[model samples]
Target: MEKSYQAAQAFSGDLSFLQEPADAVAIRHQVLILHCLAEGQQPISISWYKNGEPLPPSSYIQQLLNGSLWIRNFQKRQRNGTDEGEYSCAAQNRYGRLLSRKARVQLAYLSRFHRNPQPMAVAEGSVARFQCLTTAVPKATIIWERNRTELVTADPRFTLLPDGILQISGVTKDDVGVYRCLATNPANSRYSDEAWLTLTGSAHLSHQEPVILSGPQNLTLTVHQTAILECIATGNPRPIVSWSRLDGRSIGVEGIQVLGNGNLMISDVSVKHSGVYVCAANRPGTRVRRTAQGMLLVQAPPEFIAWPQSATYAPGDNASFSCVVEGVPQPTLAWLKNGKYVEVRENTRLSDNNRTLTILRVTYSDEALYQCIAENSAGTNQASARLAISLPQDAPKLPEKVIAFPITSTAIQVAWNRPSPADTDGIIGYVLHIRRAEDPSTQETQEALSKMTFKHKLMNLEPSTKYALFLRVYSPVGISRDSGTIFVTTRDIVPKTPDFSVTTVNDTSIRIDWEGAPPSSTIQGYKLEYRKMPCTSFQGTQILPRNQTSFIYYDLEPSSLYQIRLVAFGNSGDGNDTHRFVSLRRSGKVVPDPSPDSEEEHKPTLGLIFGVCVGLACPVLCLLLLFLLYWKRHLCKRKTNEGCGHNVQEEKTDQAIEEERDRNSEEPTELLSVNPTNVAEADSSLGRDATRVKEDQSHEPPHPAV
Candidate 1:
């Protein structure tokens, strides 16, 4: 029983403690607990070990009732690096012993000395960095400070690193100061030595000489013009400016003035002020001086060289007038008509510096008094002329609303109103001229008795033809230009049949070509009709524009004959149709029809006959099979009845035999009472007779009657 118990308590898995101390911790603040388990059996003793040896009892360590070893206030015990090592616990019983895996424990401490922060010198707009290094068991949080005050790392210019490094970006003069770093943790806190930052660059100071930013340049001015000169300068301290003439003359005298910002102004300048001027800039307590100069000029005004003269001209004639001028500075010249400024137009032109005014195709409206004017800065001049027109007579104007009406198929009546009084000269008679616009050879002329009569009949004109007509008035003066041309047309006549030909024909469409109707015919459109051959009436008709010389008819029957007709229509009526016969066949080739016998042979007769015969014979065949099955079943039943009859007969025979034997045995009993001796002999004879009868019955066949 002891051995069995010992086997049950054997260790089965790796031995390890349930709870172990952290790998590293601050001294005097750490505690370690080692809980060990021995499967199946309680340990007889549990103890703690350090460095592979039994640990001596001390105020810092103890064992608990639950097989756990506890350590408190762990500290460094040796100076040769023996203070940190593995710790373990052992549990033992009567069966076996187990030692738990080693758990390491280390005593932690703060660094002994803090490193000094590095001093840095950087140019403005440059980055500066300071470092603080130290040795510690646990990583410390780093803090940056400047001038004894903590700095917020959220500022974009300052950065604090975890390893006690401080960075200042874009360092300016204001960033120069004392910097310090602080490192802290749960064990303790320490600060590094202070560091100083210095900045040096041009951004810290400003020093420059005066620079001329803008100044006046050489210039020229006309007489009686305003002049202005400007000079601008820049320096560390603002500079003062003064203006004077280079010829030792004081400015701001005799209409000359000085403006703020070193600009000189001269009003209504004259020839005396036409000289170089100087501008000077100076700074207080500085010996440096700057200067700029500008020049001026005065010019004379214009004067006339020759005066213009008046002139006369007839209507429709070209005329011109001349004037000339001269001055120190060229002057601008202009022309005025009747005291109003003359503007250049299609009929008027100005040339020779506006010294000459020309009129192109002069009319009554252009007759007026004209003047020439010249001007300059100093003075002005003028000249004048008169224009006129000379004429014998003016052309008669065209009448309004000329109209024409059809009088006959080849004639038209034209009428109009008299010309306006202002345009008509004394007239005696009028002449009418008419001609076909399309054929100028066909023309006619007629004379009327008086110009007052404004009606005439144009005779012998072509039907459906456009004509150009005009009327003119005549007197002692040459006949007036013909009035505006008027176009007129006689009533239309029936169009002639158009000449056409079949261009293309196909199974489904037919294309025809034709020459368009003559221009004189005035045909509006064409009417096309088609029908199958031998048909009386035509199918639907299509109307085509007069310009359409070709048309295609669609949806025609294939392998069919057709008759097509084309007729031209005018305002009067449609002309006679030009007919043609056409056939719609494939590719213009006829395919012969198949023979009737072949068509019939290709029909599906065999499949139809076979299907019909199968449909009718299936029920007859099924009835025959049913009759055969019934006959077979009937024969089987008849045979079964015959077998049963035979079995019944044999059974009846066996029953009879049993009855006969029973009767015989009863007879023997009766004989025993009659005579004992005679009974024995009688019984023997009866037995023999019974055996003989049985053998005969066995040998005999069944009776058919039974």
Candidate 2:
């Protein structure tokens, strides 16, 4: 255990004695000496410490033998409040060695004061007077102070009457705080009890600057909404603040009601309030000074003009919505479902009412109208936008036989004649979202519709690539319902019709393509088909999944001029059908003219010709015959001639023939005239002719044997 200091050093003398702490409450003490016993040695000195600080850096109590040397009185110590503890008395010899033990005195708050003053209260708007009314047994004299400064000592604002009355005339609120009175007599003076003075009067400015302020720096209100306005100001004497409407109207309570503060205020401010507002401050001391300039802007509420005004959000799905609002006070956005704040991961959930609100990993409970409110010192503005959470009533069911254009395939044009009746909130838009069909993440994209129409034409699809598509409807009342899927494939041909009627139908179908090509779009094929009126099964629908211009209706009855029209389908299942009327584009036939060389006499019997005939006994014939035809003819003729003239020619021919034959044969076959060692040498090579079969008798497999 650490032991505290007992008594640093003690003052003692054999001539007399001093009693220990005799008074428990009264801490002042004195050492009484009946006789002076100290002579040869020396008198002792007393030192004090309020928790280790010398009582006085200069004065130390001395045990003087004469009356001048004697310590007639002693006092306690003080800290921030006058009274501090830990006093020690020390005694030492001139030899700077031997001394007596020490004595300690503990003092508190006001200390063992020579005197203390009492209360002196005064009325508002009146001259204030305070005096140090204190009495020490030795009859202490009086002095005054305010803050830490000596009141009557030097301050011109303060004066002391010979009668000891400390007075300040016509005192304003500036003199309202705590003040202290000090009574001085000789070595020590007691402080009067701390007294406070408050003056009642008009407002006064305490702080400097033309501070500009608005209602509340922090507020949430709806966009394009109305709200109140105000500002912040500080001063003494309580300056009066008033808020005024731009349209001219006085604000705040008046007279007997104490107009309280004079900050101007306006109710229901809209875009009209988006301007500079001046806050006027007036006080008795500080004249009328208005705020430099403060601006108030009224913004609009969350009226969603974003990617998705309404959508179906599934559990653990991402739902992003945005809104732009305007109001006097800027708005704040908070996402709530069924009326409660959402707590998602920091990044996944966000509120930037200034622009948009995003919610990731959205759940069913997150379906509700999110309110983005803007508020200011005046009032609150609010706006609400709705969201929904739902899954398709059921997965899509592939449509029945769809008669699309030959250019359009792998798809069908569908407008749900029948959809799930469970759609209560009505559908907001249809989602033609398609995943990799192999991935697990349910990513999605939604195409919103302008109306509640059952028909929607989708385009740009990969042939034979299956997709999972669902529709979700929304109503202002119930935004959480998603309709079941109505699976409709896209036409193989790029469908370009805004909407159409099929006409001009016959055994062979034909239709004019009118819908413009899709932006940067490509198509693969088209499908064509037709069934008799009221047929049970599209009797037979021709799926011409290619870009076939016209298709013959093979399924129609023979000799039956059936009504038929073509519908073009692209690879992505988007298609457009020709008018229902079967209008055949009478195809023009061409007749070739007779050659001028007159091989076959002109059989003008019936036909007249208009097309030019292209003939080529050379260019044309070249395409008709192969190089092998010349080889066969030359090969047979070479054997018939052997004269030197014939031989020379035959030799050239034969040489050419031999060279050709040699070129055709591989080294292995030519090796019949060489040594076996040479054959072995050729076989060892890694060249194509060696490693692979030699370029000879390419038709026949080569053998190692010569």
TM-score of every prediction relative to native = 0.25, 0.18
lDDT (tens digit, per residue) of candidate 1 on 1-706: 0111112113332122344333444455477565654443332445566776666556566777776766675666634334467665554332223344455665555684456777887667555667787776666777888898988777777755445656565678878899887778766788788889997664443544555544666766667877777565555455677777889965657776654445577889766776788777777678877887777666655556776654545556787888788754577888876434688999899998788898888765575556676766644445554554443545444455567777656888978776666544466677776655433223356556476677877777787676666666666644544455566677666667776655334456666677866655546666666655444345545556666687776666666655566766555444555666555554442212222123344345535545665778876765665566557656765664443321111222323432332343223332221211122342233323322211012112322220
Query: In model 2, what lDDT does residue 483 have?
Result: 38
Q: Per-residue alpha-carbon lDDT of model 2 for 159-215, expressed as tens digits?
A: 454223455544565566677766554336566577777655543324444333323
**On a 0 to 1 TM-score scale, where does candidate 1 land against the true structure?**
0.25
Q: How good is model 2 by TM-score?
A: 0.18
10 residues in a row with least lDDT, candidate 2: 642-651
The candidate scoring highest on TM-score is: 1
